[model samples]
Target: MIRINRRILAQGALALALAATGFAAAADTLKDIQARKKLLVAIDLSVPPFGMTDAAMQPQGSDVDVARALAKDMGVEMEIVQVSGPNRIPFLMTNKADIVISSFSVTPERAKVVLFSAPYSVNQLVVGAPKGVAIAKMDDLVGKRIAVVRGNLQDLELTKSAPKGATLVRYEDDATANTALIAGQVDAIATPSTTVQTLASRNPAKNLEIKFVVKVQPLAIGMRKSEVELAKWINGWVEKNAANGELNKIYSKWMGLQLPDMKKLADEARAIAL
Candidate 1:
């Protein structure tokens, strides 16, 4: 008698379902959006400076502003669906969201599954340690215990480059990682620059300082791989907003820093063409 692996079967079923959703979405997502007259965006309402809920419980942040701007450019109403980091890609793959604007960083692995428009913003994953830890570079992580937020790009990056002797403990989120570092549960933490900055701002005496950069992530909007038309339209919108300095204004308003110069959407498009 043959036995089935329930886990494998379940995964297969989910893959089929997601593929069906993708097929239904097809290549003309822009047309569908126009017909429906509403753009569905998946955003994380928990991460601040990028996405969060205001006192009125409405999504308010840089990502939220960008989403609103995109919807306005499309001449459609905006509908936001809150999501966490782990589930954002799944939501897009399953056709539950038309696009993801929740600080979605562009990576080769993710690019294989979904299309990314030009980078909308950029952030760095940095290693932070207590004042006397004496860390200066990636090599210094050897023999140290580092904390990182599970399933985040920083975790992936640190996992890849961390020396074999280093111990990496992953917590559920940035808050947990920061807590562990503060309590001396870990020698250091790998997290976004924003997170570390906020931590330092809140507790000036903690003496947590950035040691080195783990990775520099270029964040972009995400859509189904099949949605070429929608990607093109969104890319165009991003280019226009960026050129008009609207995106810089939004970033400065939320992040308290001026947007840095980087490759624009058109440059990315040109690279793809080449």
Candidate 2:
């Protein structure tokens, strides 16, 4: 009988091992989450209206409400995993969260690495400054110091359109950026419209006013790349909640702003799911 070559068998075994590794790295996350029986939601607790600690020191905000609604739809308990602006996506990539509901905006760059569900909310980035500040438009920001939370959608948008002479001071989070604005360390700030309303209203003495609109970003849930089943489930849940009026009520309660048109988004998501 002819003897089999040991080197050929070794190479074949190595190729099989590599294939198995690749498959494991891309395991079916949806089934894993279902097996776990609890959904791990990543949220940013420092952003008000979207996330923050209530008087009882429990997490509460529009994002928190959305997470609860999703958990309810899935018939699973929600475990809130607090994350900061810079760390939320990392947590998702490292398998620390089933999904992120932290006002995550969909961008083409981000789409390469993570899948985004249909938008559940709309955010308008606006420039906020003292009433007497002369910033009336993007051009007015030239040479002025503006604070923005680094890596946030507001930061990316503002940086894109900022005039050449503008000083875009990046902070670690919303609270710090807002503090820098209030303490007169920065001439103005670029942030979510809801945040501007919450902070300015709470500190009326500061006389902060919306200087101009920077950009409008649609916020959606983010999950691991190629999680088609999970994406479909989330989209269907969002569509159901929107039609039942539950989503609108939650947004109204925390944001105090009229909900954006979600019908088009819901329809798109449903089409994808089907």
Candidate 3:
């Protein structure tokens, strides 16, 4: 009791000091690793089958599982913050998050603004129609209303490939978008395959159907642009877990099925962990 290991004492002291003054808290995620016992992970709370609170009001889904596993491997816990799309990057910029574990799409425009972790998952945009809508293709939406969540990757994707005569009706969140579609405000909802699947399964609408008709997008973790060291560490961490097959288990749990022969994309992503 009288003799204490100096390094252990130092770590304990540092933890106490950081908790008291939050001085060490200003340091980057790596420093947060040495000082804080938990990793602060940001996620989108409105979307499902990715990152969001479940029916029990607890953070859950694919990205949430990955974050938890990564933090555990790093000898830390995870503090999940429910955030929105517009607020994610800004939150990281303000040091409110160690990393964004949200299903953020990696794009050239976005990559310039923040560092992206290796893609852990890929998802495709889909068209969802309730029982009576006969929207067989993008061209079928002439003068039709489509529900889309504002400030999301789907919205960006829709804007890029907007149909000739479709009206893009934006909503604040998925629940709103789905509701609007059900209420005849929108003929269909444009979203990712996973969200459309979750919506149809959880709250079934009459003859609801989800179909994939667009390019798939890669989902990655986000961090500040300058966090090269931590980003490197995260890339390694993700790759290692993926190689070990942990990501597959998590994917199956949340997504409810095996992705159709996309193991090559996952393997290539691991090889390019940078």
> Whose TM-score is greatest here?
2
Error of 2 at 172 (Å): 1.2
Best by lDDT: 2
Residue-wise C-alpha lDDT for candidate 2, range 172-266, written one tens digit per residue:
78889999998999999998888888888989999989989987767789887768889889988877777778888988898776677797654
- Computed on alpha carbons, the lDDT of every model, listed in order, comes to 0.75, 0.78, 0.70
Worst 10 residues of 3 by lDDT: 1-10
Tens digits of per-residue lDDT for model 1, 102-147:
8777765566567888877777779988789989998898788888
Question: Each candidate's TM vs. the true structure?
Answer: 0.82, 0.86, 0.82
In candidate 1, position 32 carries an lDDT of: 87
Clash list (residue pairs), candidate 2:
none
Whose lDDT is higher: candidate 1's or candidate 2's? 2
Which runs in model 3 stand beyond 4 Å of their true positions?
A: 1-27, 259-274
Where is the poorest 10-residue window by lDDT in model 1? 1-10
| Clashes per candidate (backbone, < 3 Å) | 0, 0, 0
The order of the candidates by lDDT, greatest first, is 2, 1, 3
The runs of at least 3 residues in candidate 2 whose Cα sits more than 4 Å from the true structure, single-residue gaps closed, are 1-24, 265-274
